[model samples]
Target: MHLILLLSGLSFQFSHGLQPQFVFFQTPKTWSEAQNICREQCFDLATTHDMREMETLLEVVKDKYDDAVWIGLSKGKTRRWRWSLADDDFYKEGERSYLLWRSITDDNCAVFSNGKLNMYSCETNKYSVCFDATKQGADQYILNTQRMVWTAARDFCRAHYTDLTSLRNDAEYQIVQQVANGSEVYVGLFRDPWEWSDQTDSSFRYWNPDMLVRTDSTQTCVAMLKVNSGKWGDRACTETHPFVCNCIVKKLSFIKLRISPQDSMLDLSNPSVQADILEQMSQKLRSYNKTAGFHLKWRKQSDGRVFTKEP
Candidate 1:
C-alpha cells in the first residue's frame, strides 16, 4: 500500500493523483492584480502545458465572464528566449531572452519556417549548431558544417561534445550565421508558449488566429476572452477583467516506493533522512515540470516536530 498525502487549499484528502482545482474570479482586475488575487485566494494563476490543459482551462472560464480573464500566460519583456542547455543561474542581468528577429512581423510569436523566421509551431528538424563550452571564455560555438536531421546532429554533437548551440543575442546569431555559410542551420531558439506566473515551463498554446500580432507594446500580459471560445490574447497588465486561478494540490504520493534494505537502520524523524527525502521529491517534481521553480520541504507541527506516526 502507498501513502498519498494530498493538501488542497487547507483540505486533506486521499486521491489517486494531484488534480488542479480552477477558481474563477468574476471581478475585474489587471493581470498583476489578478495574479495577486489568485495567490491570495488560491495557489496561483492556472498553468497549462498542452492542448489538453488549454481546453480544460477554457471550459472553466466559458460563459463566466464576457471580458477576457487573465491566466498565467504572458510575454514578459524581461525574460524571453532562453538557452536550451544553459543553466538559468548563469544568466546575467539583461543577458538572456534577447531577441532581434530579422523580419518585422505584427505577431510577437516567431518560428523557423522554410528556413526563414516566421511564426509558431516552434519545433523543427534541421542541421545543428553546437556550442562547445570546453573551449573556455564566451566563444564556444562549434559549427557542424554538415547538414543533417536535427536529432541525428544533436546526438552527434553530444557524442563528441556538448549538445545544440543556443543564441541569446544578435552577436550569437551573427556568429552562427557566419558559421552556417549562408545556409539555415538550427540553433536552440524556439517559440515556446504558456509560461506560468510561477515560472513553470509549459508549451500550452491556446491562441486564437486573430489573437496574433499584438499592436500595443504595453500589452504584454495575456487573458482568455470568454467570447473567443476561451482563446488567449495579449492585453495590458493594467487591464481589469475577471480572472482564473489554479490551485495545485501538493501531493506527496508513495505508491510502492522501493526502499533499499541497506538503508533501513535510520529513523524516519532524522533530519538528514528528511532532507534527503525532500531532495528526492524535488527532483521528481522537476521531471514533471522543470520550470515550476518550486522547492520541496518537510512541514513542521506545532511542537516543532517534522513528522509524527499516524494514530
Candidate 2:
C-alpha cells in the first residue's frame, strides 16, 4: 500500500488535478490595473490549462457577469525564436541568432529534413535528435527513433542527454542532418508570442475560432467572454472588465497518510524519505497531464514535524 497525503485549502479541487485558487472580481478594471491588483495580493491574472479549466472558469462567471473578463494571456513584447538549450556559454558570439529556415510561418517548432529546417506545429510528432555534451566526437548527437511531440521530445532529451539539439551554426546544422539521415527530426528552435502574467509555461490555448487571425496590434491582451461559452479573445489592454486572479492558498489542511514500508526499520521522517514520497506522488500526477506544471511540497507542523506517529 502507498501513502497518499492530500492537502486542501482555498484551492479549487478540479476533476483533473490540483489547481490554483481563482478569485472572480466583479469590479471592472483595465488589464494592467487588474494585473497590478493581483500582484499586490501575491497573485496574478488567471491562466487556464485546458478545456476542463475553461469549463470551470465559465461556470464561475456565467451567472455573475454577462460580459468579457481579463485572463493572463497576452502578446509579450520579447516574442522571438529561441533554443531549448539555453546555456549562453555553449554558443559563440553571433551564433545564437543563426537559423536555417526553409520557410517561415505561424508554426513555431522546427524540424531538420533534407538539409533544410522547416517550421512545424509543436503538436506534430517526429523523431528527436538530442545533444549529449559529455560525449566526444560524432557521438554527441543522439537520435531518438521514438515518435514524440516536440514538448515530449524535449523532456525525453533533458532526462537522458543535454537537451534537444541546438544548431548554433552551419557546422552544427550539418552535423544534425547527418545524424537525422534524411529522416525529419525535431530541433530545439521554437517561438511563442503568447505569455501568462505569472510567467508559467502553459501552451494550452482556448482561442475563439473566429479570432484565429485577428491580429489587431492594439488588442494584445486576452479576455474570456461569458456569452461565448468562455472562449478567449484578444482585447485592447486599456479596455476595462471584470477579471479573475490566481491566488495562492494561505492556509493548509492536512490528511494523514499510511504506508506499509518494505523495511520495518525505515524512518519515515527522514528528509530524503519524505522527498522520495513527494517525487513518487509528483510523477503519478504528471502522468495525468504532462504539460501542466505542479509544485508539491511537504508542509511541516508547528513543531517542525512533517509526520507524527498515530498512537
Q: Pick the candidate with the highest lDDT.
A: 2
Candidate 2 residue-wise lDDT, 1-311, digit = tens: 43433322112112223466788999999999998887666357887764456677777777777778999889976555767775545767666678877877777788888777888877787998999989986799999999988877877887798788888878788888889998999988777577777655454556664443233346789999776677788888999999998775533334455656677577777889977977787677666654344345666777777765543
**Model 1 clashes, total count:** 4
lDDT of 1 by residue, 1-311 (tens): 43332211112122112456787788898888888877666667777654445668877877878768888877754434434454444444455556555665433334332334443322334556687768764457776766655444544665676656755656666667666666566655444333567556543345664443333345678888766678777777888988888766654333223343254455666789766866776667666655543434444657766544433
The residue pairs found clashing in candidate 2 are none
Give candidate 2's whole-model lDDT.
0.73
lDDT of each: 0.58, 0.73
Consecutive 10-residue window with the lowest summed lDDT within model 1? 7-16
TM-score of each: 0.45, 0.45
